[model samples]
Target chain A: MGKMELVDSDGAKLSSALNRIARDIDAVFDVLLPVPDDTRAPLVEAMRYSAMDGGKRVRPLLVVATAEMLGVSRDPALRVGCAVEAIHVYSLIHDDLPCMDDDELRRGKATLHKAYDEATAVLAGDSLHALAFEILTDDETTPDPFTQAELVRTLAAASGMAGMAGGQMMDMAAESADYDLHTITRLQQLKTGALLAASVEMGAILAKIPREGRSHLRAYARDIGLAFQIADDLLDAEGDEEKAGKALRKDDEQGKQTFVTLMGVEGARNQARALVDHAVGHLGQYGEDAAVLRALARYIVERDR
Target chain B: MGKMELVDSDGAKLSSALNRIARDIDAVFDVLLPVPDDTRAPLVEAMRYSAMDGGKRVRPLLVVATAEMLGVSRDPALRVGCAVEAIHVYSLIHDDLPCMDDDELRRGKATLHKAYDEATAVLAGDSLHALAFEILTDDETTPDPFTQAELVRTLAAASGMAGMAGGQMMDMAAESADYDLHTITRLQQLKTGALLAASVEMGAILAKIPREGRSHLRAYARDIGLAFQIADDLLDAEGDEEKAGKALRKDDEQGKQTFVTLMGVEGARNQARALVDHAVGHLGQYGEDAAVLRALARYIVERDR
Candidate 1:
């Protein structure tokens, strides 16, 4: 009740909205996945374990907030929201595998591979990938099949070879060979930024926003996406954010080239702030409805996590 | 020219048709995942390596053959065929991962993970999975958005937790625990049968054949899917086919209770024959149009590789 009163400011409103979006999207996940007692019990368990009760739900928040701002209902937005989160969650699950990052902890708990075995984790990540497309195409997600098809295309483009997965391959390559700032930036843009931007774009797609009508929104997403990564690099460099903690903390120890390493920590933080400002400027055409997105842009730079 | 004239009977006709479908489907795959010499070159290379120059292309054959039988054009059918083959290739890539079956050989060549590293293999498989969904929803696959959505949904359902991936989870669990005939049947049904059925069902979907119209066709798929596995088990039992190899051979070595092990070799062979007969019986409703499917069922039982 007290938190509800604090939601009047743009900053607090975005926070409250994010929390609400997380819960709503999570409900959608629960309904789709349920509790696995079937032959896929371990897989269902693994999927539920990775997707539920986890993370900041930033991708879902962007989808819901953007769609709601564009006059789309929470239901369809949440469906796409959950779908994008599935892609994000799966990347995390796979990225944490032993052959990859070998992470033990994620979102303050053991990573899925640690919680389950490597095989279950891999399969769960994969099933989640399939489930994302499944939800986008399901009737509940969109009564219009055309809209559903677009959602599938958008999610796939963001997750595929030229997007998230390709970015990951580059990331692994960087582990063996030193990368310059341009290469690292390009890598993170594909790795982290593409999916984030896709979440907003999917929201726009659900509302049938045309390509010409989406330039400003696309710009806003691009700015915020990069800003989010820069802030993340700063946090990982700091290595003191109690909650922003996980596998990335060891990147510096591993001599990996991150944004903070390429640009000094202060410079990286400033770049994030500057990008956040640009991100907010890109939303100037929208009215009061754009307040949540504006606050989210600022939050990208300001949040500890 | 002589080969074309030789396609008079069911066996020769189906064999020639299968070869044609494989070539057409491979061409489609070449277009979608074109060879890359860029930064994502290795990932693209890995993808092309596994998906191209490959196995029997049975799934794509089913799609094309069924679609042609129904008088559907070749382009869309081939697109769907390529999508289905993407699923099959991705499954093989992941199955050969060190954490899973860890097979070093596939199609009598070194597996993707063996040729490249394990991480590239994982990303390549993941990207291929995304590409499958991408192709299903692509405009070239079908101009009708509703049809595209149906394709996406069908592929997802056949590949996700309740489908192929879930079946794989059960398979992994079976390694540590004993499963009876019913459990193994259900497992393989989900694992192998679901996708095979989906390939046929996708053809029907492309031709706008409603669910009720597809009953006998589905029955044929079920019978042949089971028979295919039984024949595979029999092959493994005999340990004679050098190329029809990998995972099942290890299962036999480990004393896994396959169909041949449980039913006895002669009994399993009889069951496979009965299943092929039943599969052909299910095709009686169609005229000469169902000849390829009927021949394919028999081929499932009798093929050496």
Candidate 2:
């Protein structure tokens, strides 16, 4: 049902579609720039730092790969995919700002606000956040504006209070209090799972998938989102700083609760494996076409950093 | 071709459709949730604080008045108006946060972060922002889904960097450096004017006004947005805190330039008057039906606050 060679096996995998998607995403940022070109330099620079910095373009990969696997052209989905990545980058920029996480380094580079003033960093984050939806809603290539609008609403809801913001609040409150495994899982679901779910949901939306397939895709994303977060926690507990691009176990120093904190290190690892297995099983419903998605889930758990 | 009664001698008073439209806007906010429901309590309270905080609901008013003046039923426009107001309130809450403006008082009451904790405040602002578009894009609405989609694109652009955020960035930068009158005017246009223009533009859109008329409406809004900002600056210079709600003349202390700073009090006042006249002139093309919109512009300039 599929060609395996098209899927890269190397740890540093770079699919052609993924690379094109990244470039397309960068191009979207170039649109709608402010005048007096210098005024927008800081904004453009900070967004570049946050977005173009070294990290796998996983969210965008998910968007394009899913669309391709569904036997559709990737162009329309690519724009939406890039928009998703923009939102992800915006989140990371804000999360690392002085008022939020206050981290100095991201992907082994100085964080956006650390490189610039706090206010500029904040505006850059806000701008990127807004740009994400603007790109999705205003994409001329998308055939169905109504579907695009639904995608905007879906991403907004998942990325906003009921999801990411709620998780952030929980994370902040839990800093001073003890939280159990379930509480930690719920927070992770909101913070990470919400966007990931939206990624798949958006792909389905752009593909015009029927309701039943959409539900399964959503479930697949939900499982992967949690699995991905668990893998991240495990990596933070056991991975190396040079390899991971940031220090490991900083969450402990911050008194932040994660899957590793709520459960033992071994327990967290086991949970991640279980989730990956579960997510991959759901792909069975889609047959061989979901091969890349299955591999992606496995990579989340197995990757050293 | 005209009715003097439609224009209040004291101000540009609203006709019945416009007044009913405002009530209708409030009713949407007053969703019939059962008393003391735990899930909605926080959201409802936050919505009340954010929505009812009061700034004349100018954007919504523009939308409703524009729709009515174009001979559309006020009902559909009412929902959109409320949605725009929700977005406006959300932006204000975030703008007042410690991370942003760090304002303590708004409309003579403690800002959301001061009233609640910073985390709740941030989440509340985020929720309201998401809720705004959610209301507009809801499937239950009678407006065609495609039109709703277009509205999302328009509102998102107005609220995002190329519009509101662009204005905000300029405003923030203006505090630190020297700026000319053109710079100040540009900032005001992007920050306040973009949304104001969008308000009228969206109304024209909802009414399905002819493209030329819509463009004229936008031109009217552009002029009025600057005029409105000049009036605001004038008010800040001379108005009382009891009426203005915010501390009067803070812009001067902050070293922020305004039309008043660029044009002096009298010059800025004259510019505002001219803008009002121009706005009314545009309404003339629409005749007596647009009397409420004409009056609203005058009121925007002449209001004590």
TM-score of each: 0.95, 0.90
Candidate 2 versus the native: TM-score?
0.90
RMSD of every prediction = 3.3, 3.4
Model 1 C-alpha lDDT per residue in residues B1-305, reported as the tens digit of each score: 75334325788878887788768777888899875544788999999999987788888888877887888999999999888989988999998998988898887688999999898888999999999988988888888898888888999999999899998988887766678899889988999999999999899889988889989878988998899888878877675546664544677666566787778889999998999889889888786888788778878888776
Q: What lDDT score is found at residue B22 in candidate 2?
A: 57
| Residue pairs of candidate 2 with colliding backbone atoms | B12-B295
Once model 2 is optimally superposed onto the true structure by TM-score, how far is the C-alpha of residue A53 displaced, in angstroms?
A: 2.9
TM-score for the A chain of candidate 2:
0.90
Docking category of candidate 2 = acceptable
Interface RMSD of each: 0.9, 2.8
Best by DockQ: 1
Instruction: Report the C-alpha lDDT of model 2 over A86-143, residue by residue, as the tens digit.
Output: 7787677767765566688887888887788766766676677777767777757475
